[model samples]
Target: MIAHLADIESMEKSFRTNLINHLTGGKAVHLIGTYNEHHQSNLAIFSNVIHIGAYPAMIGVLFRPIGENSHTYKNIQANKQFTLNQIPLSMVQQAHQTSARYPFGTSEFEACEIEEETIPEFDGPFVKHSLIKMGLIWEEEHLIKSNQTVLLVGKIQYISIEDSILLPDGHIDLGLAQSLSAGGLDTYYQLNQLTQFPYAKVLADASHEPRRNS
Candidate 1:
């Protein structure tokens, strides 16, 4: 059940309850390897990411404050670039466990057993195991009136998708790729193929399927 909030105190209480409930199924998608500079390494699993555009290839990350100047926030502000590595179904445990505040300069890559790839010119690291790696550049930051909530906008500089997940006509096969999702606020879920829906537009393939033997 979702608890309603009347004020800050009630809101925090509701948030706490919501967070707990959301994590019950152990299937919720977590935003892994978020960074910072001044304070401790801020790592929080988030299910609030959304794709906003294709032309500019932007994404929206809604970061709720666990207090101010989190490493992830500060790092983006400093370097203006960050990487989004989509966790596979097998890495949920390590991803969920990253929601701790480690000491400043203590890389979660070490603590969480995640390997880092130092991008050519950026000041941050990318996860070594993600199937989809997106190198993004900061586009805008919008502040919300309530507390420290921030809406970050970023544009994709480069994108890499594993070959198995790429389908013909530029579509992704989530079921074959075993793509995951978050639920009701917190639980994580994996996807499987039910059926293929017809496409709206695509260039027809010249190859044809082999005929069945009579």
Candidate 2:
């Protein structure tokens, strides 16, 4: 059953939660920077990050243009570098606040009341409290004309993660991260791996694991 409401503004009049209820799972860490005309530092957070390729160790994210004039898009055009930080449940509130549209030169770190840290030689900013963070240098930028969305692709140049999250198999143990996800509108939830099956396990005969009759 689908209910299409013609009342759009009325919907926002209540609680205007982000409409993106279903993101492609495996939420990504998104950090973005853009310098305003005054050259003041502007930092923002995004969870819609995605990996584009392995051979190049690249990732891409879409930033909706800020009206007709966007300092974030311009900053990427100028500096060509940005940082991304993976958020855990602890920082959910702060991450949510970054979506606000603020003036250029406004520090989201200050607005969100979160601390910001900078690397020695990096051009963008990193979330000081995130579980994982990465620095990306621009490789390319694409403008999707029909939607006016900007797709910024960059090569990951540096990364940092908490030691506890690393597993011997070179995979991250989300169990240790306590990161969260969302389901329906405004409904946030946590996740855990119920089971990890190897290729051999799946290929094994069903009888191999089936309970035998006593």
Candidate 3:
């Protein structure tokens, strides 16, 4: 179970990839939707979507290098917009199938039988069944020199959350929404909240301890 850099590098490609990807534990799984000028929609599942900031409401998705087969990336580049749809537990199979290499210009939404919708001004399509969805505007990209993977950053322009999961204080209960999480390439997980703690601050004195729950 112990692996050093040399050990990881010497492992089989697939094994190494799975090990490294799963090492990060559970990650937010989302279906990224985009379209070109002709309205040729593209939908793909991504686990690398991460929150970059909140003040301006920015998110970032890591793409595995730019290539001719990167239809999602191409669509985002063409329109500078995209949508992130949280994969529900019941639709994991359909969401995961979006990763398949479909032909160029083919709509994964159609191929996978997942429903899609559009916002008033957003060009990207959203998953109709997704309880949480976000529309974003492409802002910038950074290249990871070591592997050439591109970190594409986008600013959140719109967000839609199902009423059941939205808490009064702005916290989202993913368990209530039945949101699906990912661990590695194909494995999916269901999240359950264990507890919530108050924001940490400097202790008043040595005798004081942080509260266990909020």
Candidate 4:
């Protein structure tokens, strides 16, 4: 199982990709919805979304090198607005289908038969099927010199969470929502909360740590 850079580079392309992607374990999966200047909608599944900050409420999505085929990237670039929609377990197949290489201007929402929804004042469409949705404005982007991938950051402008999953303390329970997560590129997993802990503070004796199955 030991693999160095040479060993990894020598592996088959698919194997290398899968190995590297899976090494990160489960990743949050969402359908990024965007719109072009023509007002055409585009929806694509992305697992590279990450929380950038809470103070400014920013998120980042890593996109492959911008190219003619990068419809989502182009749409976000053109409109500066996008939506991230969480995929529920029931819609895993439909969400994955959004990754297909449909021609430019062909809406994946329609091609995949997923309903599209819009909120007041937002330019991008949201997934009507998703229980958790967020509308964001493009804040900035950076190109990764090593890989040529683009890290596009967005500021959260609006968010909708299913009422039942919203906790009293503000945590969203993914298990209650039945949200689906991607293991790598193709594998899907269901989430279940294992435990919760209070804000960490170092103690003199270090004897007050919360214990589960103790």
Candidate 5:
């Protein structure tokens, strides 16, 4: 089970890729929707989305190498707008199929037979089956010189979620939405809430150290 750097490099390419990807644990699964100047829509699945800041409501997603013909990246570059739709447990199959490469100008929404929906003012289409969705405006792109991966930052301009899952304190219960998660490139999982903890604060008399379950 112990894999060193040298061991990883010597492993089979596909096996090494899956091992490294799974080493990061579970990641948010989303369908990034975009459109070119001609209004042709593209949908692709991504797992590297992460929160950047709350004040500006920014998020970042890692796109593969710049040399790759990424429809989602190109569309975002062209229009500076995109939508992030949470993949629901019910639509995991269709959502995963979006990663397949189709001909240029082909709509994955149509190719995968998934329903596409859009808000009145939104620029890109959103997955109709998703329980939570976000419309974002591209802010900037940062290139990782080591790996050639592009990190795209975006500001959240709009959000839509089912009212039943909204909490009084502004948090959405993702478990209620049946949001899907990924372990690596292919495995999908359903999320479940374990426990909720209150905000932590150190005590004046003694340090408030967290208790270990074991």
Candidate 6:
């Protein structure tokens, strides 16, 4: 199972891709929705979405190198808005299908037979079936020179979650929402709560107590 950089590079292209992707471990799965100025909607599944900040509610999503037609990225750039919808266990199949390459202007919502939900005052569409969804406004884009990947930063403008899932201290019980995670390119996983712990703190007094000999 040991693999060095040279070994990974020498592996088959598809095998290497899957290996490297899974090496990073499980990632939160989300459906990114966007709409171009022409009103053409695009829906795509992404596992690279990351929380950047809490105060401003910023999130960063990594997009692959720009190709002839990167519909999602193009739409975000066009209108400066997008939505992230959590994929539940029941909809994993349709969520993964969103990653399929479709012709430009093709609405993955329609193609995948998923319903599109829109909120007033928001510019992009959201997955109506998702228990937790977020509307984001584009903030910035960073170019990774080494890989030519684009990191898009956006601010959360709106969030809709099922009432029963939210906790008092601001943590949402994702398990209750049946949120799914991505293991690799095509595998999806369900999660369960193992345990919860309080934040660690340093003892104010470091006095040691006598220990009884066993």
Worst 10 residues of 1 by lDDT: 24-33
Relative to the true structure, how large is the alpha-carbon lDDT of every model?
A: 0.68, 0.70, 0.92, 0.92, 0.91, 0.91
All-Cα superposition RMSD per candidate: 9.5, 5.8, 4.3, 4.0, 3.0, 3.5
Q: Write down the TM-score of every candidate.
A: 0.73, 0.75, 0.93, 0.94, 0.94, 0.93
lDDT of 3: 0.92
Weakest ten-residue segment in model 5 by summed lDDT: 200-209
Residue by residue across 95-189, what tens digits does model 1's lDDT show?
Answer: 76666776667777778877666566544466777777777888997888776788899898877788988887788887766667766453568
Query: How close to the true structure is residue 10 of candidate 2, measured as C-alpha lDDT?
Result: 47
Could you tell me which 10 consecutive residues in candidate 4 have the lowest summed lDDT? Answer: 201-210
- Mark the regions of model 5 whose C-alpha exceeds 4 Å error after superposition: 205-214
How many clashing pairs in candidate 2? 0
Cα lDDT tens digits for candidate 4, 85-111: 999788889899999999999999999
Report the error of model 2 at residue 105, Å: 0.8
Query: Which ranges of candidate 6 are over 4 A from the true structure?
Result: 203-214
Q: Candidate 3 or 6, higher lDDT?
A: 3
Alpha carbon deviation, residue 132, candidate 2 (Å): 0.6
Candidate 2 achieves a global lDDT of 0.70
lDDT of 4 at 91: 84
TM-score of 3: 0.93
Evaluated at residue 136, the lDDT of candidate 4 is: 95
Model 6: residue 146 alpha-carbon error in angstroms: 0.5
Per-candidate clashes come to 9, 0, 0, 0, 0, 0
- Clashing pairs for predicted structure model 3, backbone only: none
